[model samples]
Target: MILSPSRGETCDHCLAVTVSIQDAEPWCPHCEWNLDRYEPARRPPEFGWRWIDRRTHRLAYRLTRDQFDALVADGIDRRGPALARVVTIGASLLLLVGVVLVAAFGVWLVVHDFPSLTIPFGLAALGLAVVLRPRFGRLDESAYVLDRDQTPSLFDLVDEVARAIGAPAPDVVAVNDDFNAYATSIGLRRARVLCIGLPLWGALPAQERVALLGHELAHFVNGDVRRLLLTQPAFTMLGTAADLVRPVSTFALPQSALMGWAGELLAEIVQRVLARLLFTVHVVLVAVGLRDAQRAEYLADELAAEAAGSAAAVNLLDTLLIGETMEMVVRRDARAGHGPDQWRRSSEQARTSAGPILPALRQLSLRDQASLFATHPPPGLRARMIQERTAQGPAVALDQARLERIDSELARHYDRTVRNISWGG
Candidate 1:
């Protein structure tokens, strides 16, 4: 029998009754569960940028999948290193062009004295810089940064993974309360930082922990981190430009009756036209960048499999589905005034309870239409790629005693973080 979720219905997974139906899919905002699976079968073709992106992504997937399978069959593929160079050069050029455009506009304004053009050009330049600038100030506020002294064992494990992958070690390591892990490059120097979510780490087994690290550290090895830094700015700038030029309500204009209304209407029309143009540019850039991003995900998965066996890598991906469910449990427990220890136990319980449905949940996500703005490919596709290419082997061996010690240390950090965290309603 087929199952479907209705409006105002409670999610079977999270038990939240606030499920909203969109396009016939029941979505739980609190737990992020989509009850209905999205199937893209023989629908009418999309027009414009989406159609172009659909074709581009299909080609990218084919090329990258072949390279990934070949890498698994033999050894590391040269595509990763070659692509890294291309990304770095492309990003540098893009940033350079933004700078030149702003400079040329400034020179033109000064020489020609075009005061009327100054506002738009200035806004565009500011928007470009806003998109391209790297900000790291919030990192300190949101997560605890660990130095070698504070997390020696954890650093040691990270170093081991870096050596295995032949990539540079991250400049800093941080721990947060979330159920996800990510790597980022910061500031003008682009210093690398690896952030591990404490709750997610606590939920994983030792082998799976290694798999998670392998996947994240592989980003550096495959140059995915650098590529993101290069390609993301244009897309960001375009979005920012659109937002900056979007029309404001006429009601907010000066109260001069007819004159004010007419002037506001004219300005609104111009703003909307400019905003649409900027949005179109944003869509094109996003479509182009998505192909690169999805390819990087596949390459990173291959590197992860090489580092931690096929089974462990695949297990890690499966575990991620449970991580979302576990997060909902954590939040629910926290709201009920549960302490840190209880939160940890609740996480474990959620993980166990989710085991049966994890596969189904992942399949649902895979069935969803691949969006032009998504950073990674569908999870089901990733699983298939892993199964096809990854060979079975023992995960990277770490001393059990040291692993236990790191776990204990992180647990303490999690307790402190939970206690100090404030959830303002």
Candidate 2:
């Protein structure tokens, strides 16, 4: 992914720069002129399977999106103790019961004096229980956590945004050098954390920052069942179990002719069988979550409009849709040894310069079905929805002075992020 320009060559669309000969053909680093044309061929396999699972995912996406849209169109809002929620609760309970039953069975077998079975079956059962054990999402200790005492202005902004959305303020705020922001609750205590990406934050206008904050914090109160305490663990457990049981490459067998070959073959068969079963269940769980997740996203968008304004929310979606362009700006800056502030300045310049290409990018999003399998709806669709709504002024405004204070508080982290991006961190 080195960015280079050959002699007498420039991007056809942006005329900014072209990729190196070693990189993919006809790809422009600046405007992503022809990137979408090769997306299908370049997409990797899912769930350790090839075309079969990929096709399944596409089908699931279509069905889920169609259903969600139709339901919304009919003014039918399904949330709170719906059938999906019930199934989610039942599924989690069943998984827990299965784990307990397996552990109990293992213990009973060991005490029944079945020595032969004890070593193989009992231990295997106990091991399966261990792997299937429920997971509570844990706090990411590796993240650069912003201390409240040190970054009070930033925390105060977050608190204001949370209040605007009628959600509790996050217990922690962390920063990263990515193109996204997210909110998640960790551990049994459900301590919520708000993670902001410096690249995206720096690129955003102040009001749009409030829009971004509103969208993320709204996840807490938007009936997003995937983020719920009980269903969240259930939604993740099966996929994790499948991953844990997936066999390594069968091609890398032992050198031994007889004993090793036979043992490896048996283990591989068992692992593959278990993996398939777990993956099937995981797909089902994900399918169940999809419709509800899609609904939650649209609702969160509405809340974002309420907190910020319909125009700002729509503007935020437009900014998000240009993620590839922003990425190119960063990549080129990294190679050119641009200073730390270049991220923000270059990003805004790229965005502004590429105005003519923005419409095509939006159409490309719809053409590629880019957000079909994603948690959120397509940016184009979200923006359109926001535009259709009655426009409201910002309920929680971020004035230039306040934004400057917030920026001052995050100055060190921003510098570190820029340095990391420049040095290829």
Candidate 3:
């Protein structure tokens, strides 16, 4: 549904066409002005005072403020959260056990029980096991993957950053259209895939980019429970199951006779109850691992500081705080036919414009807090911690010339990414 500018409004940034679409805020489609305020209806609320969320938030804040040094001093160790790791791994094992038990029971029922009704029930149970089976992480097909051979300079920089932090370099790097970047393990071998988001990458400074790399690469060795092989599958499996089981609506129900309607209603209730249960368990798993997860994040930030310097690391966190604005600017430029060439300048301008408001935004972060279920600590807290600690200069710095060469190598990927952005892909 395309919405035309009703009031003949133009974008403040580029004087381009502006419009308000259904379930979206009024914003310029051409230059993306006012788009920062445009929240998509599809996105869920990011933070709330729900039981687990609230508890997690409180715990995160306490860790950030009261126990910051103690955690830093403790360093990365298997002993940090034994019970949490045990519970998380146990949950994953139980999921696997559940699948095997269900499949075995189904086979027994099919082989030994009455074939008429029992066979159908047995097949249904087997199908349920298949649906609930654990899955390993895999790279998204849409991602533009770059190998070391394809991007030597970029890989060299990554290798340098990994060496600086004393961590393993990613096996592969993938670029996507997301507004954020992540480092995750994939396949049975747990090969690390470093996913760099074009939107965020385009907006960051060279040193901040190095900091970003440092932070993500540090995750490889930081002992992040969620990323560990033993617990990662459980998180992936449970999260997938939770997403598959959503509240069923009455209006979506099929038409039926009176008795049939009652039976369907009972079934719907059971389904909804099961959905709620899955979601609750997922939430509990997140809550249980929240502290250790947050500790890993802070530790990663510290390592990022060591790898790229404290100033760059803190600045990177600030950039993250303004991530939404940066995304809007990048999208605006891409849609305006300005493309990647114009993104850095526009993003710099956006960052400059945000300076006055950055403090307020940081305060807002403290007041509202980050989501408890999130893997990282609050951006504001992360930045503050870096600043409060001793300052460190970059151990492995990338000169401007090398940075440009790396960009030159990634130019084609950036162009493809920008094209996708323009088409709303």
**Pairs clashing in candidate 3?**
none
Off by over 4 Å in 2: 1-39, 42-61, 71-78, 110-123, 240-274, 331-342, 370-372
The TM-score obtained by model 2 is: 0.77
Best by TM-score: 2
Displacement of residue 230 (Cα, Å) in model 2 is 2.0
Residue pairs with backbone atoms closer than 3 Å in model 2 (clashes): none
Candidate 2 lDDT trough over 10 residues, lowest sum: 363-372
lDDT of 1 by residue, 1-425 (tens): 12234555886678876332224355564454553333234223444465564664455444444544554566545255455345444654675577667756655654565566576666665555555453332254567888787778889888887777677899889988777898877765768888987767765666677878888887876655334555545546667768878986635755668787787889889999999998887666665555556667777776677667788788777766455576666666655655445665776676666665555555555435355555776675576678876376744765568778786667668666555443621
lDDT of 2 by residue, 1-425 (tens): 23345555677877965543323344465565654442444444454465564565556545644654665475435255556667767887787787789999987777776665566777788888887776668766546889998888888888988888788888888988787888988887889988998778877778888999999998888778778776754677788888988887748655667887888889989999999998788777776675568677777887788888888898788788878888777767755755335666887787677566554454444425433345766676677666666777889998888877888888888777767876884
> Which pairs of residues collide in model 1?
none
- Greater-TM-score candidate between 1 and 3: 3
- Comparing 1 with 3 on lDDT, the higher-scoring candidate is 3
Model 2: how far is 409 from its true place, Å?
1.0
In terms of TM-score, how similar is model 1 to the real structure? 0.71
What would you estimate as the lDDT of candidate 2? 0.72
For residues 348-402, write the lDDT of model 3, one tens digit per residue. Answer: 8877887765654554454344444566666876887788778999998877788
